[model samples]
Target: MSAIACASLSALVAPSLCRALPALAVAPRLLTAFPTATRQPAALSRRMVTSASLTPTIEDILVEDHRQFGEIMRRYNLATEKAEKKAALAELIRQVAVHSVGEEKILYPILEKIAIKGDAKAVIARERQEHKQVRDMLYDLLDRNLPVGDPLFERDVEAMYKYLAAHCAGEEVSDCPEMARFFPESARREFGKRFLAVKKLAEDQVAEEILDMESKINL
Candidate 1:
């Protein structure tokens, strides 16, 4: 049985389980230098944390991402215009797709370097499975070939919203916060920096590919 995406999102290892379980946050050590990313336009980089940020931990970054995901979904649901809805859904897919991978590749694996409980590894396994489900849903969203105005397009987008809402909620509650329980503050910050780098790298490459794919999506 797979735990659904918190974005596992976070609940699998709550504070009560902290002492008994292991940590799953990103960052094994302080990164001597922040990773480089090509600069992006202000509009495209709406929710990203910059290198200039004085002090935001990785938890803050992930939480903010969850919030952004929700907001994009709401925008998609509320949008009356085709263009409006299309943009919102495209952004939602891009953010969730990338963030999920970031956690898998950067966030959780670093924590594996430390001594972790069997349950924690199990939680990570579930999260990885959840990520697979999410990826499948995203591909389904695209493969449906439904344009913004089609009723079926609305149906699929709504379905994605519900799934992601559950995923984000679980992560914010348990997965995100427990990251701080075991790791030092520097590790958290380093993870944030690394995650942001991933986001920046995706800006032109992944986001554009998704936008182009969704625009042409029509049954």
Candidate 2:
């Protein structure tokens, strides 16, 4: 299955929705295992090196990240334990922040250059605005360290999901396909490598910030 199609299916069976179905007993375990099979860029690179023929494209990397984010969100929403919820939320924020930064720095710039200049600029601007909104929500969630059951926490989580889902839909339907048309096969693979590097840097920075915050809270 295509990465995008897999992600869409995973999102449908996410804990929140699956809980209402007859398969609820197995859903959690299935959902938990689903993320383990996702393709990370490092792993993809290694496979490509071994095969020397099948390289992942930039869209593949992005779609994989989106799936990871969706799975993390599902974990957060379904987590009954405080620690589980906290970990899920932290990872969700980290992934979303990393993906947004990578897109803005790497993908959107390439899109702007290759696409019709005016239209690309407008699209990038709108996407950036959405990213800003998501970042603000994430910062508030991280800064407060509120209990998962808190009303404010639930509200913010819902809001974050709504914005993120909309943004993902837009990208999958419009931006990614359009951008893919402009890049050659080799360039797309190279871009995937760069995107993964940027994502790792972003994830490390966010992890450090989270650790620092926790240290201060403990003090």
Candidate 3:
């Protein structure tokens, strides 16, 4: 009779123990389902560096510009009136000018040294010429307050935009590859440092100029 009673008690207690053990184990997991904080965004300097000694490539710079330029183009396309178009055009010009300055300050000299004549020089030179052409067009757009549908405004800005897109694509595919192939590891790094320094300086100057101009225009 005593043995029978102990068996009966054991059967009842085993199921309860199993359920309690699982509940205890799973409690912490359930509690952790609440939202939690995350790490802050990475810094720009930290992002571009891969290895301790590796240099940033022209491809990297151009790729960044492509992303930024695409956004500006989208904004321009969405603009409604002359005022909106003008604002978009201003932003586009500002971006292109800053980008050109950065490339000239940092990228051009490096490519000019490594690239062979005819193909390389012409390619790089053409990009510089495009920059000048676009700058002139941008100046015209800004100086003259014309309707968005006007032929002059449409022709100049669209031409500049098309030229810029093609130029950027060529740099990423052809010129940048040549630059990377020609330079030594150390040379690449040195070039990258110089480019970054000059790029920063140019960006600051562009920003200041834009702010002053905007202030004058009350934009």
Candidate 4:
């Protein structure tokens, strides 16, 4: 949203509806511009590398993402102040939301195309369901309809933390290794490069999500 518009909003509504824009904040309602679960960069390239590889595979990259998620949670757990915890949670939500885009759009489809384990479809379905649950929990935490002081807010945060930890463990042990088994080093690296590129494209959306959730944390 334009500065004048946001200033007017701040004047007319609770400061919480439109706080001072953070360094990463984009236009107001930018989060609403993209669909909740499917927000992604339209121009993300799908090219594959044909040559032998010298770098990490998609499995490696996915593991790194899991590690990052774990670290975010770790810090959130350590945080004492409400502002600190909310800020960390906003970032965690943003990272998880964007990370799902590359994994679902780019990585999971290979398994759908050809599966030696015969459970690719079932696995993808389960993973997608879990991703939806995480997204929903974040929305519940910030939903304006809920009592601003509701105890459910704390319950949802703790529940999501446990749920996300288990989800990451599943991907780290099972899904990521499946990526390794399915693709050779060169192909894996090529797909990994593409996934990373798409993630970069989602940077603005990530920032918008963080700002949106942060603004909603009135507690």
**Over the full model, what C-alpha lDDT does candidate 4 score relative to the true structure?**
0.56
Off by over 4 Å in 3: 1-56, 81-84, 148-152, 184-190, 207-219
Per-model TM-score, in order, reads 0.69, 0.68, 0.61, 0.67
- For candidate 4, what's the RMSD? 15.7
RMSD versus native structure for model 3: 27.5
Give the distance in Å from residue 14's predicted Cα in candidate 2 to where it truly belongs. 36
Clashing pairs in 1: 5-167, 6-9, 6-167, 8-127, 9-171, 10-174, 10-175, 11-175, 145-218
Model 1 residue 64 lDDT?
76
Each prediction's whole-model lDDT (CA) = 0.56, 0.57, 0.52, 0.56
Weakest 10 consecutive residues, lDDT, candidate 2?
18-27
- The segments of candidate 4 whose C-alpha lies over 4 angstroms from its true place after superposition are 1-55, 116-118, 144-151, 205-210
Candidate 3 has a TM-score of: 0.61
The reply for model 2, stretches above 4 Å from the true place, is 1-55, 142-145, 210-219
lDDT tens readout by residue for model 4, 33-81: 1112221221112222235554456666676776787888788778777
Candidate 1 clash total? Answer: 9
Clashing pairs in 4: 1-27, 1-28
Query: Model 3: per-residue lDDT, tens digit, 89-167?
Result: 6676566666667576556655554444455566666666666665555555546765565777677567667766766
- Candidate 1 scores a C-alpha RMSD against the true structure in Å of 12.8
State the lDDT of candidate 2 residue by residue for 1-219, as single tens digits. Answer: 233322321232212111100000000111111112233333432333334555467777676667787889899788888778777776665566667767766666665554444655666566666776666665666568676768887887787787787777556555556545554566677777676666666665556655553332210
